[model samples]
Target chain A: MHFTSEPRLADGVLEREFTLGEIPGILWTPESASASAPVPLVLLGHPPLGLHKMYPRLVARAQRAAADGFAAATIELPGSGERPRSATADQARADLRRAREAGEPVDEEIVDRLVLPLVDKSVPEWQDALDALLSLPEIEGPVGYSGGVISIGIRLAVVEPRISAAVLFAGTVVPRALFEEARQVTIPLHVLLQWDDEANDRQAALALFDAFGSKEKTLHANMGGHTGVPQFAGDAAARFLARHLK
Target chain B: MHFTSEPRLADGVLEREFTLGEIPGILWTPESASASAPVPLVLLGHPPLGLHKMYPRLVARAQRAAADGFAAATIELPGSGERPRSATADQARADLRRAREAGEPVDEEIVDRLVLPLVDKSVPEWQDALDALLSLPEIEGPVGYSGGVISIGIRLAVVEPRISAAVLFAGTVVPRALFEEARQVTIPLHVLLQWDDEANDRQAALALFDAFGSKEKTLHANMGGHTGVPQFAGDAAARFLARHLK
Candidate 1:
């Protein structure tokens, strides 16, 4: 991991722009954090909207985590943020639109193209970032994951032993294989679902929730579209995270 | 739909090789079927294995449907049977393998490529075939759909008013969007699930089962792999069709 800049944000929170090879990311740390007494870390997974579009939420969530005495972080997903988009990605999007318009099934292979690389490239980058963040004095061992692009969370929860808990947003499309992998996730999970999401498959979300082998998993379903997650839901998720992480 | 050849099979079952546009398919009818008094039809969605590979099961199911007084039929899925494999299909398969090996999510777009065309091309072809078969007066309305390749089953259930009931196999990978489409399905459904399908996402199967808007949808989960549907399960599924079609 390469740290290029470090800028201090509000209330003793420090934001650092860094890169793990080609993947760019940001890490936020609270002022009271130290190596001798490290705080828990929370990794944020941005929604389909690029990181810039989600800056407000990312900042807010990170700030909240920091204020709660935890270090927060996020990484750019493949083809999102400043990452250069590939022909494959563009074609994949066209295919999806065409399939949706035609009311046809998107081929599993095409779906694999869209999600696999992001998961493949993002998880390890996030893990490496975790290593970098944990190397610092302020970030501790136990970790938490939050946000959309749920495949990433599913993977992290399964592979990354340090992640003690996760708060998963249900709006994203989860690949079929992930549901199988989800059975391996044992971390405490708090999943938020928008029951009336125009783009999300409610059954898929519920299936994912059911797929998680986590001993402790809670589903919070609310009425509305993709962005309709209520503040109270977020608060409840935060509390859930606090209980597990803190 | 055009029929090029008709041959008599055992048990007074009649098999006809036909084409809807350029797509090849087969249709079967019982000995008792006649233009004067048509029987109900049952469209079969063959598993990923080619028609030849599934011929025994197809023959058995069609025979059973025939014995139960329903015309049964099946068509080649894209890239299966004698269908010409395209470069896109090969690439999609490679992409799926690469994603799976790397433990990554298949991009949704890529997934669209894999499934959309099959659903788009096949559903209409199936519908056209239905029209032609019904025109013969040997196959009446109130059709039933059975077998795997679930997306086709979903689309048919939602859009085809003629189909009164369906028996859906749960081993196929269903696109997430299909779950939403499934909500529009009001046909009586009997879904067969192999609880331990090695190639299937069990949660996805269950989710699809839950997504069906059918007032009467029954889930039969058996303990086995993709091809592990016991004879009893087939008997049960056949009985389900008999109840609705007969």
Candidate 2:
């Protein structure tokens, strides 16, 4: 892990841009963070939209976490942001987009081809990011994963024992292959679903929630399109994280 | 309305039993309640199982509302509690019970017979009780309806303009007839569903939530049976009331 840019402070939070080998990432910690009293960390996950595209929302969430006395971080996905893109993945994405634009049912094969490889590649990056983040003197354990590519989040919940809880956004395309892995996730989960998201399936989301192995999982479905998650819903998700991490 | 018992203080809340004609009821108000800054009210909704049987839970919810500086109240449903029972309703209830106990699907007519009359007879009584409760010096408007027989809450949310918001418990049997009424409910709603409830149909609950016309509705589904709603879910519902009522 290497710091690629100077750390900056905003609203009492220390934000730093860094890189793990070739992957870019950022971390935000409260001003009170210290070696003696390290804070719990939350990994902010977003759609394959680059970190720059998601900065406004991610930083807002980071600020909220900092306000709640925790640290947050995120890493660029393999084929998103400035990272090198895979031709196969790019082809699958174009095909999926064309199908959706033409009002065609996205083939299960297309979904698997586009999503499975991303999940295969990103879960490790997140785990590696977690490894480096936790090793920081001011960032500690009992970590949580929040937001999407929900397939990655599901895989992390199942394989990454370091993540004790997660707040999953059921707003992304999930491969049928991930359903079994979803059932293997035993960590406490707080899943958010946009009730009328055009790109998402409500029944599939509900079925995934049922498949989770955890005894403490909640589904919060709000009315609106994909981006219209209400402010109170965000607050409630924060409270859920605070309940588990604090 | 006539006060049937002396007012008692518990946890800084004033609790009193009252009667509207033949209907028995209870009211709870915060210590901060006054005519000048009249507290908002929340009408506690529940199954038609009699107040004596539900007092512990009702008073607990009332105290929670009072702690948030809101007055709460409840009235006996017609054909329930110590009130005169209707032979027709009793027969419907028996038939419904036999169907459930025999592991058979409850007929639509049986559901209609059991739920419709109670909804018709009780909605007016609720309005009358609301008329009396809001007339009190310490109670004010921006009221909320919570818990269930969800059909009553649906009707109240539709017909009672005073209720600006509601937190409906989707843990009871909802008749199909209320689907249209559900669509008519335009108030801000926060609905709770016990996803694993044996008596409640999860898909039907989800459909009802979808049919609601409120733009600000949210569905909070937790893993549990009907009576096993977690403490955090209750706290979240209370927070919802505070946001709308206060």
Best by TM-score: 2
- Compute the DockQ of candidate 1: 0.01
Cα shift from native, residue B102, model 2 (Å): 2.5
DockQ (C-alpha based) per candidate is 0.01, 0.97
Candidate 1 interface CA RMSD, Å: 11.4
Worst 10 residues of 2 chain B by lDDT: B168-177
Give the range of the ten consecutive residues with the poorest summed lDDT in model 1 chain A. Answer: A215-224
Query: Native contacts recovered, in order, as a fraction for each?
Result: 0.00, 1.00
What is the interface root-mean-square deviation of candidate 2? 0.4
* Per-residue accuracy of model 1 over A1-246 as CA lDDT, tens digit each: 788886766778888888878878888888778777788988888865677888889988888888788888888877777888767767876887788788887677777777777788778878888887788776776889998788888998889988889998878667788899999998878787776787677777767777888766656555567887766557667767777787
lDDT of 2: 0.92
Query: For candidate 2, what is the recovered fraction of reference interface contacts?
Result: 1.00
How close is every model to the real structure, measured as TM-score?
0.50, 0.99
Question: What TM value does the first chain of each candidate achieve?
Answer: 0.93, 0.98
Evaluate residue A132 in candidate 1 and report its C-alpha lDDT on the 0 to 100 scale: 79
Q: What are the per-residue Cα lDDT tens digits for candidate 2 across A1-246?
A: 999889999999999999999999999999999999999999999998899999999999999999989999999999989999888899999999999999998899999999999989999999999999999999998899998688999999999999999999998778887898888899999999999998788888889889888999999999888898899999999999999999
